[model samples]
Target: MNIDPQKPLLQLNVGEFLDLLKNSATEKKYEYGLKGLAKMLGCSRSKASVIKSTGILDEAIVQNGNLIIIDKDKALQLLAQNKK
Candidate 1:
């Protein structure tokens, strides 16, 4: 690549920059905390906690200190399998 002092090195409009950001990033596919899980599951927070305690979602659950995050798709799949 040759350096060009007379010409602009790069050019991007705001919309193009935003689109690039959107396409370049991977979105998180998990839910945070029991409340988030409840919202995703369409259940009460207490119910989500109960489900967490059952260990049925163990494979989908991630715990860091007191914070809990659940992989939404995996949890739903596990629940569906459990129902069968």
Candidate 2:
């Protein structure tokens, strides 16, 4: 049996990962925490720290807990405007 080396060697590229993250953020239906968002965004909890520091995504307060997800409207607006 031949094994495919490319399998598992191909993690989604940053742009692809970011696009997925944006889409997921746009579809959020419940409260999520920073760690949760980090996990969902394909970043290790450590990497999430870096991403948040970079401000591509931000933390928001929801009710009594913390929610961490991208701003869907802002992301779509930016994508829309940059297309021109």
Best TM-score goes to which candidate?
1
lDDT of each: 0.84, 0.51
lDDT of 2 at 6: 65
Candidate 1 regions exceeding 4 Å error are 1-28
Candidate 1 C-alpha lDDT tens digits along 1-84: 333345452565566667666776987799999999999989999998998999999999999988998998899899999984
lDDT winner among the candidates?
Answer: 1
Full-model lDDT, candidate 1? 0.84
Deviation in angstroms for 10 in model 2?
Answer: 50
TM-score of each prediction = 0.66, 0.35
